[model samples]
Target: MSDMTAMELDEASGQAPRPLRERLSLGPFSDEWTAADWIVGSASVLLAIASAGFFGWSFVVSMKSPDYFQQAALANMPPKLDRIETGSIDVANAMPVPQIVRLSEPTPADYQIVMVFNNEALLATRNELMRVKVGSIVPGLGLVRTIDTEAGSPTVVAENATLHGAPATR
Candidate 1:
């Protein structure tokens, strides 16, 4: 019975150590390459050739200017000149004069309600902005209260503005 190490087995299999450059080269296949290696190499070479051909054709087409066939057809035509009599009415209809219309800006609109407290002072809003979902928030001068517009004027009762009169004395 004989015992063989890893290096001895490698040498016995007739497989030699390759250089780093050869191993890193375009050799994805092994030494004894199967049918798949040849097919892959051929396909890769064809793909590279097709890519280079497409780029070369594109560059050549872009470098040269196009000459249409219409230029050659027009060259065979003869040149002629004609004259018109004095005050000849050649047009069928005359064009009307154009007028420029100037547009003006529209004026802004505002709605508000004034509240007076105890006949001494009053609260009048200068600028009031109201939206659909978001209501308006205005500070009072002599009274502090919240105004809700759910129903008609009945919703805005006098009880809502109960904070009238002057400040409380201590």
Candidate 2:
């Protein structure tokens, strides 16, 4: 306030800028480098650089990540089937399915289900099949006793789904 510019006052109080441009410094300390000082300075700089590197890598990955997530809203609905065929044969063998139609849904006795796999990347897993046999009419389809058993054959596999990872290269 006394006719001194802010910068001039800083200079008078020995707190001027024009530093941190080079060399390590601390309060009242300049060009002196000790073992502890070196360790502290090196570690701090290394940590800052490493943090920056990690943040940059994360940003790049986020940018390059698959655009599929934009369609995440679709996941909330019953998947729109690429192909849905109702039959006794498993059609998935002839095709590849990175995406699949779930044939495991219950059906009226008139029609059976078929699954087709057509995604090239996951084609190899097209034939890994699991079958579960359920006894029909557990209440009535069973044996001729007061308690019923396997009157007809249903499958336990209906309730289960499979997971397969397509191969990848580095």
The TM-score leader among the candidates is 2
**lDDT tens per residue, model 1, 1-170:** 15975456557888884565555555654555657977998999999999999988867765673443355557877744432434444465645658633253211212233332232222323343322111323232222234433232212222223222232234
Cα-based lDDT for every prediction: 0.43, 0.41
- The alpha-carbon lDDT assigned to residue 40 of candidate 1 equals 94
Off by over 4 Å in 2: 1-28, 66-136, 141-170
> After aligning candidate 1 to the native by TM-score, how far in Å is the CA of 164 from where it should be?
63
Angstrom error of the Cα, residue 67, model 2: value is 10
Residue 134 in model 1: lDDT: 15
RMSD to the true structure for each prediction, in A, is 25.7, 18.8
Q: Cα lDDT of model 2 overall?
A: 0.41
